[model samples]
Target: MSEAPWWRGAVTYQIYPRSFMDTDGDGVGDLPGIIDRLDYVASLGVDAIWISPFFRSPMADFGYDIADYREVDPLFGNNDDFDHLLAKAHSLGLKVMIDQVLSHTSVEHAWFRQSRESRDNPKADWYVWADAREDGTPPNNWLSLFGGCAWQWEPRRGQYYLHNFLTSQPDLNYHNPDVRRAVLDEVKFWLDKGVDGLRLDAINFCFHDQQLRDNPPKPEDKRVGRGFSPDNPYAFQYHYYNNTRPENIAFLEDLRALMDQYHQVAAIGEISSEDSLATTAEYTRDGRLHMGYSFELLTDDFSAAYIRSTVQNLEAQMLEGWPCWAISNHDVARVLTRWGNGDASPQLANLLSAMVCSLRGSVCVYQGEELGLTEAEVPFEALQDPYGITFWPTFKGRDGCRTPMPWNNGINAGFSVGEPWLPVPAEHRALAVSLQESEPGSALHRFRAFMAWRRTQPALRLGDIRFLDTPEPVLAFTRRHGDETVLAAFNLSAQPVELPLDGIAGATPVNGHGLAQGTFADGRLSLPGHGALYARID
Candidate 1:
């Protein structure tokens, strides 16, 4: 237990602060609210918690538009509250990892302000600003993820500033060394506050083509959502110049060097690239990021083949680098609702949890996942996400899955005394923490038990996966480590299936959840519908 690397086989829970909980009846979750629930978070058996931004912002994109790097937003409390939360989390034996949005900052940030003002200030080159063409058009043909042109004209500076997302979050000019040093100093500010690690937001987008070259148009059919909208034209471009530049590698090396100064301090980058697989491998290779995760499993597709191919591709390319796997997060829909048929079963939830834990890389479990909570419906008027508002009907955006966490059956699910910023789903109340605490077989209890059990299986934790040839609705794999082997089989369909086990080997089920049991004889193992089995093979 003491021998594993800090990140390998670790389970991290992501907390979207605004919806997690709220103290002081402010309707928005704050640092104090998180501190109050430190014990409850630790009881879930997660190794660490990745809290989304609580820095000062204009709330245009919630806290993602960071206005100030050092000060805590008054909406979320001050620096003292953050320090208190850190101490409380560490006291409960839980690690704290803050989200760092180095790629961009709020247009209102002091650096952006100084950069936009007069253009001769010391911070003039801090943000990506370039002169417009003679016709007053943008400098280049780059589109913003929030729709329209990625560059916005600043009348005072007589230039266009680049914004990958909202115009409020202007992209930083990473080509400038002064900007890099300033960003690192902000990183040091959090490290000095005793955070164990950092979750680098949109890490690859930190640097772009300094020449401002036009991104070649990609075929409409060849687009995928690396992070932004897949259906939008933003995805229709190759994005060769906007992100994942060669300049990012040296900055990553500098970042790694800084983290190496502390014991067990790690950094995981959120890689959103047109060539995400190649970039994920490169960003994590050697001494770059400690790990990087892409949108491989966070899509609408859900099949045994897709899952197998994604993992196999990473295994072939990543080699020595580490990967982090996540099915649902703040930006994506809940897997049960997005991938599963509308009527999601508790059995499938248990199966998905087991599957993610069995993967070779680390895992991130979003809040309310333990309850097997599916996506909730938020009325158009109640939708706070700008992305959803802009692309209504066709794509409702991420608000459905970003609802308030259910803590009790009481009003507002006990997330706050006042009305929560996001509405709590009526269906989620029955699966509240208070109700699940009393039920022995509840998903919440099963999550804790299964996580504890997973810690004991070294084959599942650090072993290589060998996919077995199997029929539809059946996913089989063997995790092997130096003569020790474990066979994991899943009946993906709603009907029974029999798996043939060839060669000389013995097996026994490592029961966690009360999944179906099968008897094996003459190299054949019989399984029932919605069944799964993990066996110690000898």
Candidate 2:
């Protein structure tokens, strides 16, 4: 137990660069801005910082569409700025993890530019290309997650290229050994430069079906899942061919072998497919990915039963692999708004963070989550996200959660002197870090306290979890490791509730986590309005 890997059950803070801070007054956050805030991140007691992509891109899908894998985008400063950031972050005891988007590259990339030019070019086979049907339509019924057809016609090559996401992000041909070697070289460049980990975005989408098969139609009731809306056409199919292919397993093993060459560097893949939980389990087992996370808990379902079933389902299958949990990320709506429904609060925010961290795995805390920031209501006219713009009224895209971080009540909420890429919500300004640091019971302070206290509890950090059968609104579980066992319970709603501990009746209260405290007396646990309880079992 003492020899467990550092990433096992560790907490990683996800920093969305464009919205984190702005140093050059360009209304965009850069690597230097992240360097300026390293101390503040370290103060939160997280083991590592997972920075979203800052690689060279066309800004089509923000930074997820990489144009140049070896260099930092000029918008984010040069490679030197990143070196300084890595050094400063390590000095503050924070490990750094950068995003690696290997599934696709920006159309502006050299490989894609060449691949789209001609059929016989050396790089022509570097991308997924196929001839159109005799009727000049797409080769298959594969749909893009961003809506419409997955294949974009290339006139120069007299063929169509595949793109699982935006058309500007052309999918790479992992079937080609040269492409795999090139992608691995790009990944090694970062590891050689001293990165602690890699957050593999769309890692499951690297390989496509060589047969170009059409996906089966999905039932109406089965279409509702995380990241998929009922209105989008992508939800209409089972997505058996376009992504999460069986070929990805071998690629993952190749990735792991490359990562094994480094010291203590880990890789966490973001899984999204027809069956994400099963894919998460499959991609993480054996020597594939070091860890994997899916969109299971990031959905609109916040009930105890739904949560219990989701976690238990993953636990039942992921026996040989490790998992990482994230309630919110750059792609989804904020958890406070998503999980809290309409009654989000500081107490609720801290409670949700603790509950997720208490699970038997590592955790990823999104930026501004500690401040309990809700989704911003960005107007359609000012929206920058192409996804949101394409799905405007009904879906509203992910812009609500991608707004700039509010550091103060000043103009642009002290995020930038220039106009921000996305407007900083006035509500977020009220909960700025400066103001929250002064307030004793603020979400920021409570999150910090809970994380600090969580570091001291070995059972909470590295123990095996066993859930207790409880009624609605009350979620209870026990964590045991070595000689220590801790019992935890949370009331999801604001209304006061009481639960009678059945067989595990008695608990010695462990306080000072700065959450909404609950009381344990006799055989009953009384919790008032989003209250939580933690106690030693023995």
Model 1 ranges with Cα > 4 A deviation: 226-231, 502-504, 513-519
Lowest-sum lDDT 10-residue window in model 2: 221-230
What is each predicted model's overall lDDT from 0 to 1? 0.85, 0.91
TM-score for model 2?
0.99
Q: Write the per-residue lDDT of candidate 1 for residues 372-471, one digit (tens) a residue.
A: 8899888899999998887776677788888888999988999999988888888888889999999987878878887887777777777888887777
Model 2 CA deviation exceeding 4 Å by range: none
Report the C-alpha lDDT of model 2 over 1-538, residue by residue, as the tens digit: 4588778888999999999999999999999999988899999999999999999998999899999999899999999999999999999988899999999999999999998989999999999999999999999999999989999999999999999999999999999999999999999999999999999998999998999989999998888766665588998999889899999999999999999999888999999887788998898998999899899898988899998898899889888888899999988899998998897788889999999999988999999999999988999999998988888788888889999998999879989999999998889999999999999879999999999999888888889999998898999899999988999899999999987887685789899888888888888888888999999885
- Write out the backbone clash pairs for model 2: none
What value of lDDT does candidate 2 attain over all alpha carbons? 0.91
Predicted model with the maximum TM-score:
2
What is model 2's C-alpha RMSD? 1.0
